[model samples]
Target: MTMNEANTYDRYQRQIILPDFGVGRQQKLMRAKVLVIGAGGLGCPVLQYLAAAGIGTIGIADDDLVSLSNLHRQVLFTVHDIGLNKAERALAVLEQLNPEIQYIAYPKRLTVENAFEIIGDYDMVVDGTDNFSSRYLINDACVLMKKPLVFGAVSRFEGQVTVFNYRDDAHDEPVNYRDLFPSPPRAGEISNCAEAGVLGVVPGILGVMMANEVIKGITGMGTLLNGRLLTYNACNNQVYELALQVNRDARVSMPADKKEFMEMDYDCLCGVGDKGFEIDYKTFSELVRAGDIAVIDVREAGEVPAFDKFDVVNIPLHQLSRELSQIQAGIVVTVCQSGQRSLVAAGELASAFGNSKKIYSLKGGVLQWPLLHKKELS
Candidate 1:
């Protein structure tokens, strides 16, 4: 055998020796290109396994930075990686794990303008993102491009896996994410991992499972999760699979063509916009410094890393209604651990005050405040 062939065999010999997965399957893996969005919990294991499996080209897309809280679940990063971009950091670590593979890091959030361009280059896509806006955006982009997408999601103790926009045979019509959830959930209706705490192992388990599905799909070796949803409960270690049916009516919610898709506002549709009242940390800082706005910490009392930089009212979301009178300022801003509860609080405030008060939710919440403004604060 040639030196290169001998090396490839030595590297992946364990998998190559499997009953059905031999050098042929390994070769297919080496030729497949996959793009993984969100280098957080799920993306970490998915990237690690896929890289070790020798996927020819892997792309990492994420705009978030490594933070203390992420270390528990995002295994790819360490304490030293804090404040560093997740995609770039993941790329660096993944390269060390398997230098034979090629890695591309897009240190930016996936949006409509860039989704198609980046996704178009990959044969299949993996949905590791946590938010509804990104989930729907990636799903729609994959549907439009007719690319297969492997999806994974984790909550408090439950995790789910599925494959979208994939067909096993020529006669079958493919099903996309929209076929399962036609529209985005109303903001705050479904809490993410940030809002509803998740056990670190939940995502780690689901991420490895997602990587398995990707390999299965690429090498055509096993039954794909297409048209099926598998849900796992880590608490009891129970697993169940549900058959997913196409929702024809859901197609109406999808963009008619690429033109309309590019113009769509997924954030607003997902309720993250809060009707244009969601302000970033910079805007929140400016408003706070102005001393004319009432900053309300919607998180419950005793939450860690308290925001004591300025005078603010401590009102948990559950008690916001009874304490509405406490906020005397005409301009109000809501804050929370991860902005989910604050978005709901802002909606409530808007409902109560109408046009009489300018109500806004601090996007990304207090957890990200110090990270985003450390330079200015220091």
Candidate 2:
């Protein structure tokens, strides 16, 4: 039970040799339990480093299977792991890397109904998920359960890392993700790694940064990314830290007597707040075909199969920011497969081009586009 005990400092000797993270800190890490919400790109490095660093227990929560595309960034899986459950593959890797750590593959999505179950056991929770629904859920769960959340996110050439709900004797305020970003930018505003094409090591860098933050929180040694956001632009190899403060103006307005932690329609919440913003599909299509608007299809090259072939211009969301000068402007109509990414793209474009330009995004995306009975296949 002591710091200098046998077999204790042996595994974590390298970390213990560091100035701030010595034997006492290594012991804290070994005694800590960390729950990572995804086993994808971000989760892989987080779980691997934490396990190797001697974190006593790690819970991997995700229900997704490894796809050929995932191998580009999700380092936990290999050619043999293709089609296998992400959490399952990750657990096997962790077991091989560090048998001393108890790695738990929850092998299920973190829904509102069950987020608290596994999250409650860990010393800190890491939001490694890559969706708005999951991100909002993680943030709310942390706020409700009073758990510290170490967050990481990545896109094509950018990554973000931050700590939320962290406070000790000196600082008692709990800051959630909502406090930093206020709301999810409407879909399409930000592109996913799948759509935007992220650098394989982007998540690795951010993930390790997240692990460092969690360790900092446990030992209370250095300045955590608490109330601060660290943005890494791989394209430029630059790291910038932005100050984050509780936005009184944007505090989530919730019902006081709202009982139970049922899923907070993040799409709806995100719709109203800054989180991916756009109109439903029907209206967006109407404007695009009206011959008076410019339709921007913010989908990747081969993602989701282009829904509209009729006159819509293909400007993938990640490239849209730079390709705007090339957009044929009539009143712009932004759309994607499900409308999520398009909306985000639309919002970002509007921010740059002002709102009065008559730009609109598809609501339901092409998937939600209504099919006429006359077109039914016999």
- Model-by-model lDDT, in order? 0.89, 0.78
Query: Over the stretch 55-119, how does candidate 2's per-residue lDDT look in tens digits?
Result: 88899999999999888778878899988899988999989988877888988888766877778
- How accurate locally is residue 274 in candidate 2, as Cα lDDT from 0 to 100? 40
Candidate 2 Cα outliers beyond 4 Å, as residue runs: 1-9, 17-23, 252-260, 272-378
lDDT of 2: 0.78
Best by lDDT: 1
Q: What is the Cα-based lDDT of residue 285 in candidate 1? A: 77
Query: TM-score: which candidate is best?
Result: 1
State how far residue 57 of model 1 sits from its true place (Å).
Answer: 0.6
